[model samples]
Target: MKTVILVALLLLLFPIPVLGGESGLVISSYSVNPSTLFPGDTGKLVVTVTNTGTRSAEIREAVLYGNGLKVLSPGYSKLGTLTSGGSVDLTFVISGMKEGVYYPTLVVRGNDSTLQYPILVTVDSTEPEVLLDTGILYVNEVNRINFTIINPRSGDLTSIKVRPIVDGNVYPEYLYFDRISGGSSAKGVFYLYTTKPVETVQFSLQFNNGENVRYTNTTAPINSLPSREIQISLEKYPNEVLRYDTVVFSGNITNLRQDTIYSLIMSIEGDGIVSSRDVVLPALSSMDSVPFTIRVTPISSGTKHLTLTYMYSDVLGKIYTGSTDLYIQVPDKDVLSLNGVEIKKDGIELNIIGDVSNLGNYEVKGVTVSVLASDSEESYFIGALAPSDFNSFDINIPVKENTSTITISIQFVTGVGQLITIQQNLPVKEKPVLKEPEIPKKYYILIGLISVLVLVVVGYSWKRAMQ
Candidate 1:
């Protein structure tokens, strides 16, 4: 009875082999050649079928079906027989229509059994399209290379590197983008300078597709123009100014091109002067000109330099910056002066005659003149004088012995009503003495008495002779 029970347990555990072919068919393994496909990208799906049972399996046909996936080749693979523990590979070339996850089914029909399996496929379909927006690139200067990257599909791109390569070295050679979603765009810039000229350059785009890296290159021609495109000229009123005087600065801005410039902005800056200021302009058309003016007062005397910066953009979103310089000279302030002077000298006396005039653009009031000689001083009063007008003045100065020079000071109030003193030096010379015949102090009285006596004698002698 124990032996019978052991036989029955063995029979239950392991079933006896069938007389006809005992077969089993299963999908052992499947793989995607590239594992991922971009939209319109072609790839292959490989399915491996195996007979796992003890007998051989005959496969009549196998078919793959999915949505948005077009099979390049015939959709089925035929296999005559699959031996026991043997595997067969079925390849299906397919192209993806758009980006998304897809689940494909693989059905295998055999003589003994039928099997259905699910296959996983991913269509990345996200491609990066890079473009250069800058039109000109100059050497030995900070030239901006503007670029844009666009993702056109519905999938996301990751680990993107945009690199600019040229004949010479480029500053900030590359830019990185961690992740870019579908239907999105990003902008970047690279600054480059070269000692020599370069004609062409290449920009490379690198990004990750699943587990692989992809590279794409684009070539562009460099078209550089002169940096100073806008014509600017500065005009200063009273080009030569005096210290502490207010001056007017004027200028004109003209467009030198035949195209329209948008968002035109200008700024003014100077050294040792006021802070920066900006000028607003709406637009600039071809051959257009605009005038501007500013007033400034200088405390010290010297040359002043001004810089005008112009920033504008073109229709294609290209930016251009240019600059121009202006110079102004400042002179020292002038004092009141005397013109058309005449001097006459006599014995211990001097005469001075001159015209007092205002040469500058200022009024002078309370005018007075003083003469100092031999430590003695004298003053003369004159009235107010207007600009470009003159007045005459005369003065008699007394000089002492050994006095060779005299000082003349003129006092007045300036245009701004400020007290001022102006002075001039006048030379002095003494008149020489003349020598005459010497005569006694009483000679005129003695001569008169002699003449009277002679007259009486003559009359008495005449009377005696008549008697």
Candidate 2:
């Protein structure tokens, strides 16, 4: 006592490519929800009715009409039976008043059998797209913007977020994405810095399609352009620093851009610095310059403060950093002077040779040359002396006896590293006095025959002292 099958939804100008006749109940699958629709959007048009053969099928009512797709879900007096191979599903709420494709139909009348089906609905308005993947954009430095998040519309799109408005200055207000699979595209990065002039750079796009909720507003235009400089040059550092000297800071690192530059790095920091060496470059072409050296030894003296940091990348990789500054003048350990001291004597020992010149312009490391006789002390090691360069040391020492003078020390190490020693006082040479051997002419003829026999015995004693 329950049988009502009056389903209809005809509107297919030239549809019917597959309609069932023997009535085993057909109309297998059909769907159209948020698949697409935007003129008045509000969708749902599902239909699935299958009975096949060998059986029970008695659907009483189901109706849906179509024009621009307006069927507002009404008829359904009694959509009840469908057993044998069984299946039944019919819903229709669709409302998208015009924009494009629409072909709805789904008739199902049992017993006399008449199951026709056809479903396809789409009413797009198309949105979602934001361009500008960086080519040039800079006014007051720092600008590597890139935004391209397109989902032109076909279906998938949800949660995806993007925000960047650079008049108030933005660097990453928000940029999230969980899904974006319609036509597809994704990439967003920002790091803007504008001090005065700015024309455009705003992009705000929100998403979600199935439940309907979307927004899009994009703008990418700015032609102020004037920010490109990465040419550090320290002039080979060395102005004048003698006291406790040990300062070096070399230069050259120009890569003025024409593209090609990635992962370049350079470092040097100071504040009483005593060691350093860092420089790596993975790539760098176009304008290339490279060459940097730093060797310090400052326990913080006077006006010293150094810094030279750097980072690079460009060619879609983005990142680009900078830093440069150095000021030096450490005066306090230079008063050493005792050039070319020489003292050679070899037997009682006492050599003390010389030559340890650097004359100041830079380079001077551990130049030694000691000597202190008697209580004994000898040394010589002059290493790394280059500026006018000169190295030579001899030291021997070993000649005592109240040891006159002879100190001679002379240690050096200045370049900001101070360790100087200078002493001088030499004198210790006196040992030569012995002259007695100048009477050899046969002893001068035997002293002249003993003076003529003492004058013949004094002339006979003067003739007998007068008788």
Please give, for residues 112-195, the per-residue lDDT of candidate 1 as tens digits. Answer: 566666566678744577777887765444466787888775555678898888865566878999977767888888776554
lDDT score of residue 109 within candidate 1: 79
| Candidate 2, 345-428: lDDT as tens digits | 656777767776665566767777788777788888877677766777777778864577778777877665567676677887
TM-score each candidate: 0.42, 0.38
lDDT of each: 0.69, 0.69
* Candidate 1 regions with alpha-carbon error over 4 angstroms: 1-115, 118-127, 137-144, 152-154, 166-173, 182-184, 191-201, 229-232, 236-336, 340-402, 408-424, 428-467
For residue 430, model 1's alpha carbon misses the true position, in angstroms, by: 7.9
**What lDDT, from 0 to 1, does candidate 1 have?**
0.69
On TM-score, the candidate that comes out on top is: 1
